[model samples]
Structure formats: C-alpha cells, structure tokens
Target: MSLINRLSTRSDDFLATLRKLLAFDASQDESIERTSADILKDIQARGDDALLEYTRRFDQVEAASVAALEIPRGEWLAALEALPGEQRQALDSAASRVRGYHERQRSETWTYTEADGTVLGQKISPLDRVGLYVPGGKAAYPSSVLMNAIPAKVAGVAEVIMVTPTPKGTRNPIVLAAAAIAGVDRVWTIGGAQAIGALAYGTASIAAVDKIVGPGNAYVAAAKRRVFGTVGIDMIAGPSEILVICDGSTPADWIAMDLFSQAEHDELAQAILLCPDAAYLDEVEAAIARLLPAMPRADIIRASLSRRGALILVRDLNEACAMANEIAPEHLEISTEDAGKWAEKIRHAGAIFMGRYSSEALGDYCAGPNHVLPTSRTARFSSPLGVYDFQKRSSLIQVSQAGAQTLGRIASTLAHGEGLQAHAASAQYRIKPD
Candidate 1:
C-alpha cells in the first residue's frame, strides 16, 4: 500500500527493522530439521514406495513408475513445435545468451611446474550428474529452466536432470520447450521434498544426482537442506528481495514498477528504495499509489510493501550505499548517474543491476547471470548459482625424489605439531630413507 519508514530507526534499531523487513520470525521455527528427517527416513526406508506416497499426498498426482515420471522424448519435441513462433524464438535467444554468458564461467584445469619439476595444479571437471528442481503448479517460468540448466551444460556436466510438479497430471509445454533449449538430459513429473529425495537417494525411477538446484516453496527449501550432506545444493534461498538506489534522475513510475516486481512475488518479499532526497521518495510513493490497484496481484504487493518494503531518505548516496550493504538484498539496482561508480561501493548483494536500461527482470530472464541468488542477507557470504555449482575441484600434486625430501620434512613437522604420529610417519617415510 505504501513504503514503510525505515529512516527514523537508530543504527541499533536497524537490525530489528531489518529482521521484520526480512520477514524473519524470531519466534517461528522453520521445522526443516523435523520435516527433512522424516522425508529422508521415508525415502531411505521405502524408496519408490515412500516417494510415490508423498507425491500422491502432497502433489495430488500418481506417478506409479519411473518410466511414467519422465516427460516422453517425443512429447518434449512436440512441446517445442506446439509453441507460437515468437515464444519459441524468445526461448532460443535467451538460451543462447545464457549459454554464452555461462560458457565464460566454465572452470579450466590448470597446472604449474615447480623449479624442481614438481607438478601441482587443480583439476576442474563437471559433476557426473546434476538435478535441477523447478517450481511449477502455480506458475510456469521458462526463464527458470534456462537460468538453472545452462550453467551445468556450460560446465560440461554429463547429465542434467529436471523435476517439476504436475498438479493436473500434465506438464506445461513451455517448460518442456525451455528444457529442450537448455539441454536437459531428463525431465520428471515429481516435485517438493519427494523430488529432492528422489534426486539425492536415487529411487527406482529417479537417478541420484551430485547436486540439486532451483527455487521452491518452504517444503522444497527444507528438502534441499535435508539432502545437502548426501548431495550438494545451490543454497537455502529465502524470500525474494529487491533494493533500488536512485538519485531522482529516473522516472518515479519506472522505479515503483520495479519495486512492485519483487513485492508481487510473496507477502514476505521485500522491495526497498534508498534515495538521498525525500521528494524522490514521495514521487516513487505516488507512482506506487497510482500503479498498485491496476496490477493483478495488488493485494500481495500491498501486503509486501506495508510489511517489508521501505523508503529510506539518506543524507547522500554514500549513506544509501551503507544502508543497502546493511540490507544485502537479493537484487540491487543502481539507477543513479554513474551507476558503475556506486556498484563499487556495494559490498553485499546477490546481483547488482547497473544503469537505467539494466532491469532486474532482464537478469531474471535473458541476462547472462543466473537468477537463483542468495536472499535474506545471506548474500554477504553466498553467491548466485552458476557454473561452479555443477563442478568440483580436486588438487593435484606430484613430487620427485628431491622435491619429496624438501616438502616431506615440513609436512612431518606440521603433522607432529598437530599430534598426528601416523601423519608424521607417512610424510617421514618418503624422505627418511631409500
């Protein structure tokens, strides 16, 4: 409905406001530990039976067998043909851009030869298999398919699997078409914790995967957290968030529309604006008032704005940057002059959109960057899911007789310092004698 005031709070008061803005219920327990434990036990104990039961109960669909789970190859092809030419062309272009961008992120194996001829390097290779979890049912976002799968494909992963819920016992053709464009190896009609379990443990129908990725509901997030140790996960994503910084140069209508983009996601989603002048804040607020009632999800956006969104009036752009760093939102837009100059001051954020033309939605769809980003201030430590998520690195070291003698003594000393006798002996043996 309106931008909540965050400027009145003291710096110490900021944390509490931030927690409220982030929709963090200090009293609320996530129940991830409990839910994941049960899901894991059921999948481990009964495998396909457990998965099928959960799928029926939660998803309201019967996937009787693994063969029935996969979207047929012919159907996938047909889905592409079924789409309007414009839509198909869009997917193609987006896929190509995503692929080209991710291709640059591909890690390469590198080795260095020491003066003593000791070769040391890191081997970068894609995982044998990867599982992508795309949230379906309420919405169909072909962009998500492109965002999640292209990175793995670029990383040279052997297999890229996809799982989405089909509530009507049918898949969206656009989803299938996008999957084809992104080079998906398999697509399954399973979702929620059960889909995660299927990917982690490998049921009769779903193969075990090295990693699982994509955005989902709380159950899905909990499921990913549950399966983390057994397999790698992208990140435990929180609700959507956006932070826009402007110096009154951009139109208030455009700014308000951008803020609404994130607010419409969910009531818990945050849409904040950090500006130097109160007049700019007023203009944006007026724009929001004019625009909110027209949108389909106005109620959701209004709730989000009232509960979590903010319009902070700072003294200068520097102060705005400081506040933004404090928030560390999932999406940060620099709509000010010299957008690149302000970007350098941003120490925390999931993704930074610079300049007037660079909209957050572009990054969500066609931009080269992955849209799956860390939220709820986790961006301070985490990052967007990318080529690295689908790959593993192993250190490689080779030592000659002389090199061994030089390094082994140091290794033995370190082992001894740490009270590891066997470790010391193992290093000592190579250089101690013939």
Candidate 2:
C-alpha cells in the first residue's frame, strides 16, 4: 500500500476528491457529552463534595480535602529549581520568549476627542481570573502550560488557576516547573469534566473563573461547551494541521520530516504538501517511505499520513497559494527562496512559517508565537490565542452638553422613525428646548 495519498490539480474531479479527503466528523460522542453533563450538574449542585468524589473516581487519587490536592507555591518553585541546569535553562528561555511575544499583544485604553467635544474610545481590561486545563495521565506537555498561562499573565489577569489530573497520584515535574515559569497563580490535581465544572461553577474551595483555556479529552471539551455561557472558552480545536507549499528548492527530506512533525500529533492530524514540480513530490514520497521506519511514533505518523496527509501537484506557485487559502490550515510553511513574497498572497492561516528554515515545530515551542492556533479551516475566521483572548474591550463614550443636543436630536429622530416611543422620549429628554 502507498505510504500517503497522491493528487493532482489537473484531475477532473480534484475539488470533490479534496473535499472528501478533508472531511472530518467533529460531532461529539453522545455518551461522553451526557456523562460530562451529569458531572457538571453534580459538581454545580454538590460543589466541593462532588468535585472530590469525581477526582477520586476518575484519577484514582484519594485526598482528605480539596486543599490537599492544591499544589502549593513552594512546590511549583521547587519544581522549577530542581530541574537539571540544561532543562531549566530551556524552560526558562521558552517561557521568556512566550511572555515577551504576548507582551506586545496587550491592548491599551485609548480615546479621541471629536470636534464637538465628544470623547470616543475603547477601554481594555484583563479578566479577573482564568482557568487552564492540562491533560494528565502519562502525557506531559510543558509547552501547553507555557502557551496558555503566559498569555493570561501578560494580559494582567489577577489570578490563573490550573488543573491537571494526577493519575495514581503521580505528578509530572516538568509540567509543574512550567506552571511556575509562566506565572500560574494556583494549581490543583484534578482533571476531566469535573475539573472543568469546578472552574465554571465554583466549588467551595475554588472560585469561578472568568475564562477557561487549554486542551483536554472529550469529556473536558464537552464540559467547556456546556459552560460557555457561564464563562468564556478558547475554542473547540479540531486537529493539528500543517500545509507546506514548496517551490521545489527545499530538501525533500526536510519537507518529509515537516509532514511527520504534525502527523505525529494524532491520527486525525493532517499534513499536506503542495509543489509545482511533480519530481519533487516523488522525492518527498520516497523520503517518507525511507524515514517512516525509524520514527519513534511510526505507527501514529503512518496512520495520519495514510488517512489525511497528501502530496499534491499544483500548476504553479500561484495555484498552491490558492489551494492553501482554501484549506486555511492551522500552520502554513512557505518553503521557497521568496517565501515572504508568497506569504503576502495568503489570506488565511493561523500561523505562517516562512522560508526553508522556519519549520512549524519551532513555532510550536520557543518561536515567540502562541502555539494555540485555529484549526479545521477556522483560521479563515479565527486567530491564534494570545493576550487578546484574556482581555476584553469596553466601548468608551462621553458627550458634552452641547454635543448631546445634536446627538440626542438625531437619536430621537431615528427612534421615532423606528416607532419606539420610550426610546424617542429618552433621547428627546436629552435634547435642548428650541
């Protein structure tokens, strides 16, 4: 069997074929959603009691009180200090870069005075508290910790609460270390839908957060979906995706490994390559076959490549750019001499990795951009998570008495034309008698 799918833009039914390849069923499992709903309701009604019970049942960890599960500030600091010199340096550098990048994203209050003495502006304010959910049970993603929490801290969030499940009462030190470096204010060893419930509804031990951000299993996602009205959520991510547009100048092995970078994320993750030269496509395919055997996650990479990965032969660079805009992938890599020139043509993508050396993997770590990006073509309408996600803008407006006379008269006219007596009367009251 072929290692990956091959397609050509010249095919008569290429669009239909491409649509079929990109098809993904994002529907949540009914059973998981139902279970999550029950968990949420129980936690809301029972508060701390239900939270502890669910944590014990799901994580297999017993705790006398919710406070017992809370990781103290000393533990977070100790975790950071205990790391090996090299490991600690890398963590510190990554956190520093993430913080620096998000600092520029912070929105500031601004106002402009009109000629009529009316002030119009926007006031930006950070959330009071935010919750971050990190997946646990053998999976350690310090990158996730840095990506989510650093932005909140940079946005000036007063408190950041983190929850991670500790299966069998084991905690991953690197995750804790990252929490310290990212300025996470508090953490608890609780996860799944119950943790989400505790954050959204507020248990006796934990206060409700203004927003929740992070990735988790289906149960956590379902809980977030249910509690969206009560609190804000980042997004319901689809899958990891990387679309590489090559000009046939980059090394085939480099392109192949780039595909594997995202393919290794999961079976649903997609990695596609677009190049004008058919020969380069052959070379990348050959490289994929040659390199697949040695990868540590060979099975996962193979599954992802075989299912959603593709090597497409486009008519030219322009056609590749067109296809990329259609896909609106989570990550876009322009591997060419004039990568910057081509990037200008791109209308949609969560992040653009330009030039032959700018691999998507770098952006995932310390490249100074938030790795929490839009997926499943949502890049067309959405954006990467950053300080903006943790801050809200309030419209600011002030009118002088003289300005109010004119504005109120206009409002009264519009309100009367719209046939609202109360609105018209309210606006007329502000107008000066002639």
Name the top lDDT candidate: 2
> Model 2: per-residue lDDT, tens digit, 273-319?
99999999999999999999999999999999999999999999999
lDDT of each: 0.86, 0.95
Question: Which regions of candidate 2 are displaced past 4 Å?
Answer: none
List TM-score per model, in order: 0.94, 0.99
lDDT per residue for candidate 1 within 1-434, as digits (tens), equals 33455553336676676666666652324586578668878887888888888778877888666677778778878899899999999889889998988888888999999988899999998999999998788679889999988899889889999999988685788998899888998898888887888899998767799998888877777778778899999887777899999998899999999999999999888898888878888898899989999999999999988898888777789988988898888999999899999999999999999998888989988887889999878999999888988889999999977898989999999999999999989888899575
- Can you tell me which runs of candidate 1 are displaced by over 4 Å? 1-3, 6-19, 26-36, 432-434
lDDT value, candidate 2, whole model: 0.95
